[model samples]
Target: MDGPFANRGRRWPNVTVAIIALWTCASPALSQQVSLPPPLASNHATDPPLAEAMQRIEQLEQTVFELQQRQNGGLIEAEAPICFDAPTAELPTHYPIYDSGWTLRPYDAAKTPFELTIGLHNQFRYTGFSRDEATTIDAAGNVNTIPNRNDFDVNRGRLVFSGYALDKDLGFYANIDYSTVASSSIQPLLGWISFRHNDALTLYMGLGKVPGTWEWQQTSRYTMGADRTLATTFFRPSITAGMWGIGKLGDSLSYTVFVGNGLNTLTLRSSDLDTNFVYSALAWWEPLGEFGVGFSDQEHHDNLAIRVGHGLTQTKNDSTSTDQSGAEQTVVRLSDGTRLVEPNALAPGVTVNAFDVWLYTAHLGLKKQGYSFSSEVFMRWLRNIEGTGGTSLESLLDNGFYIQGGAFVIPKKLELFVRGSAVTGDFGTGSEVAAGLNWHLFDKRSARFTLDVTDIRDSPAEQSRTGYVAGESGTLLRAQLWTFF
Candidate 1:
């Protein structure tokens, strides 16, 4: 289709017809014009027919000589312009880049500046719960009840669409999840339009995850357990409409800072939100190379690797609180599982309406051979309490921590892990210990089966998704098969 002289013959038909007009008689080739013998040539260039034909032949030879000279001069002046293939130029074509792993550019991106990628994450779970007691008391002197469950569930059937437009640095993302546990059967989660200046910095706007803790920083698809830890659910910030900045200072250091509408306004309308905004920031460093997102030693590092991180978040808002666990549940909870929104929660007759909260957290993680160890600590300070009924309230403080470790029993395929966590606050103290086994179906953790059993006492965490029931001691069991693409 393309060659230096591919057009060499395309421009000659018109030039040949002009040469015929110059001749009194029709002749398509110069050889025919020159075939007339000298016998036909007479005095003064012979007969009129012969003389005219000779003149035309001479002109044609000159034209041929000029074209040859032009070709030698490196210019094809009569050639037609080059063009794209007709079929591809008019029709759009696409094929999967991998149909697995990270979705990369697969839309014949060089020809089209816009790209759209689709992804999925599926998790099927089986859980069993048994409470030590039917009812338990909280710091507020209120009795709370527990419910037991044994069944199967889905996360449920999450779908993600993300890509870039105009430029690779301009990106967009949208996620939808359908599950019975969600506030609605189908709900939109995080969605954003982002500008990535470089690996060192990226800015995003829209409903996004607040950057407040290490556990929440990594994707849920790569969790070391079937789900995040109970302590993480208790201390971490929830999804909110916000703008955030994320960047890496160097090969080992990364950071994120966010400002959002409220601590837990995922389902709230603008009228329901307060005037105050929540601010959260976090930074982590992996000194010995990349410490991958997951806590599990799936990599089986030949040498030691470590990561350290710190985070802080502050918020003061007039958000309604609830003891129930749902898609948009209240984030600020008492150690003994009492909702700050509960009437007379802090005093005999006062109803607390709002509070200012500050949380500081730190974490350390280590990996070597086929083993991994990680831990995080959280401290919270709540002040500026607002209430009804003219009852004065005092500040409150709370603290919590979780430690986890794992080692592969069969190279990279099977792993044994143990985890424990505890919480202490003005209201009460609670804790849990758990053990699990993981069997990776593929080389990556993208496909896996996990099983774990946890024993909890006066559980402070109230996240039902993580199998925690506040104010009630219990033995919980979970098994899940999860995959991502």
Candidate 2:
């Protein structure tokens, strides 16, 4: 125990000296050299010990100031010149000025630029048949005549204008169309004014064509076939010569609305025509890549017409002509003969009012890439038709559906497109198959070739005989041209 005590005592002294040495070496502030000006250099300012102590305090204070600056988020100047060529100095911070403008808004077309353009198109078509048949009756009410059907006929031509007006905000368009190949003679197709409010908003109004499911929906303007399923004709007035509006809801959705005099005066009865009250609406949405849904509607008045005819000879005579019912032919015999008549048998004053026809239609289309699937159905009812003898009457109902599939080989520039349209209902009409090819001469002008085989009754299940004609089937071929500047 005595020896252990003696060794401990010796260790304590050495340990104490080691602690003192460590304390001195660890203090950078305390170890700093403190200096004061010499008495002679300082002009005999103060005692040397006093100056040294003051200088030490000053050095410690300077070190504390620097530490505070670093803690207070202060940046220190580099001791050496900074080299911009260094990787650290070249690091990206913010977008360059040139790129900043791009993220704000699209360049305005109205203020930036404008253009003017015009276009024209022409086409001809014809149809041929192997056999023709019609029903006829002779003077005694006995029927035994077959009239020959007329040969094929054709013509379709168009002119259009488009592009910008004023600067960019305004747009102008005009189109003149004529179709001897169509059911009608000549007509002004489209004319309108358009305004661009923003990238997602556009407004168009004035006399113009309405873009619907079948007519203006095709990328190639020319390929559509004639005998446009009866439904197409019924729906045309809703889409043509109307006041229409369209709006886009973001990038995935769009909407359209229109109001017009349904059908037209020439086609509909005078009583059914609406001078200003006509309207339609459509909306479409695409949530997935290539799938879409749409809805539309159109309304018009009823049309009714009547005719009467009685043959006096073997030849067919006009129901409204003098030979059949002229007032001048009236005969009056006094009491002896006991025969008196107020008017002739075929008097023009003897008017006949016939059936009233009413129509309604709707359709849908699903398209993916180059392939498309579409379906349209419509119905018409004819109420009360005066018989051939103005004394009898009949009622008829007509309805049908058109389902089709097609592919676009060249997108909008050119395409070989075809569709199979069918009809069946009150009219006793069979299904039809149609095919065609279309070509674009310019972005807005195109030409088309088409062939359609209709009323095919080869299959007993598909035959619909109405009795008005005697043929089981017929064919129509067409070449058409269309353009919109």
Candidate 3:
């Protein structure tokens, strides 16, 4: 019994010590030691939070990249998928109605169907004559001659306006000249309105150029020389009031048909004596292609073209005496107011019946690189030259031909050319040879300088009819400065 008590006492002391140690470990104020486990290996599947965070960062990075691309002009890779569904705004349609190369145009031309363009054309010329005076002796021993003077003058000063109105289908043009001519102070060169159905068909009405020879149809501003050929000046009527139809047949062919008042007449009202009318038709086929508008001899195309055409007119004469001005009335007059022939030439107070006029023309042109060539032949016939109720007279016949060629010595800047022309008619025969150089200061040929020398040979009868004395044949030196704006 004494041994059991002693063991219990010792066990009690050990228990007390163990309890103290446990208390110390459990006390809040006592510093405690903690052990951490080794870090788990990095793995996306194992760490869902980490993997989601990385995906969010990637999405943010892509957004920044797209925003940057859009800020820099909306440039995006073609293969990239589209990110937006918004529709793009459409732009308004715009069309050009006129050539942009024109020097002047309305400010609103590009935005509207209505447009207006203004242009100016001027030609300054100096002419020197070799023979200042000519003399002629008649059968009655009467000597007739006039002094010919050299001239430095303005050949042409014109204003041009053109455009489309209402729509492109309706086009119009007006060309006015302030220069004086034989019988007029102010001239209306062309004033017309056109209804264009298409390139294949169009109709024109007003005062305009007649559908005559190609040379006659060419604009004065574009002629190769300072003056038109003698054939054109003598034969072609300057202008007419008319209705015309022009159409293109396929790509290389064209046609023109017109009905007009008598040639070169400005009267808008019917006159008792001037009841005659003119009708014309022309057709041209260009085996290679169409030629350009101007005759520059500077090779504007790269192909060859040929044109043939025929024209006819019917006219009547009523006046046979002097007018209120005491000047004799004539059917045909030269540019210098010289009478060539009239019904009165046969006899005083003689009136002719209706006469038929016919004209035929053929032309050939070649343009290749810097080389150019052109030639034309023309023939005219006048039937029924006798007076009314009188015996028949011989029909009048006239013929003319011209050949020209040139090469651009410096491409478009300079050109040298030579031309020869001849005309034969009931009056007589005349020939001319000319050589010239053209200096194109502006590439568009809007500004040019030309110098030429011409030698003329004419029969005495021809000179007489042209108001020159019988023995008028010599050289002419001409210089011209021309500009178009």
Error of 1 at 251 (Å): 2.0
CA lDDT of each candidate?
Answer: 0.75, 0.39, 0.59
TM-score of 2: 0.47
Score candidate 1 by lDDT: 0.75
2 or 3, greater by TM-score: 3
Write candidate 1's Cα lDDT for 1-485 as tens digits.
Answer: 56865433642443344454344123323323333222222342534654575565555544443333333333333342322223223333333454453454534456566767788888888988898799987656778878887989885467888989877789999989877566577889889999999999899999988877788777876667788887887788888999999999978999999999877787888766667888999999999998776898788899999999999999885534441222232567888878776665677766677678898999999988889999999998888776764344799999999999999989889999999888898888888889999999986787889999988888878774566777878898999998888
Name the top TM-score candidate: 1
Question: In model 2, which runs have C-alpha deviations exceeding 4 angstroms?
Answer: 1-114, 135-154, 179-187, 198-201, 210-227, 234-241, 265-276, 290-362, 379-398, 407-418, 424-427, 435-448, 455-473, 479-485
Residue-level lDDT tens digits of model 2 in 1-485: 46546445434543443344334334434322323222222311344643564454444343433332322222323232222233332322211112211111112333335555556655554444333334322212234333333344434466666667555678887767676544456666667888888756567776643343343333233324433443343223322344666776776566665655442322334344333333444455544432422110000002211111110001011122322322211111111111112222113233222233344455555554445555665554444433235653344455555665555566644445556544444323444466665554542233334444444331112101111122234453444443332
Candidate 3 lDDT, tens digit per residue, 88-195? 222112222334224233323444567667788888787776763486433223455634547776667788888788677898988887653224445776899999
Judging by lDDT against the true structure, name the best candidate: 1
Checking candidate 1 for backbone clashes, the offending pairs are none
Clashing pairs for predicted structure model 3, backbone only: none
Worst 10 residues of 1 by lDDT: 35-44
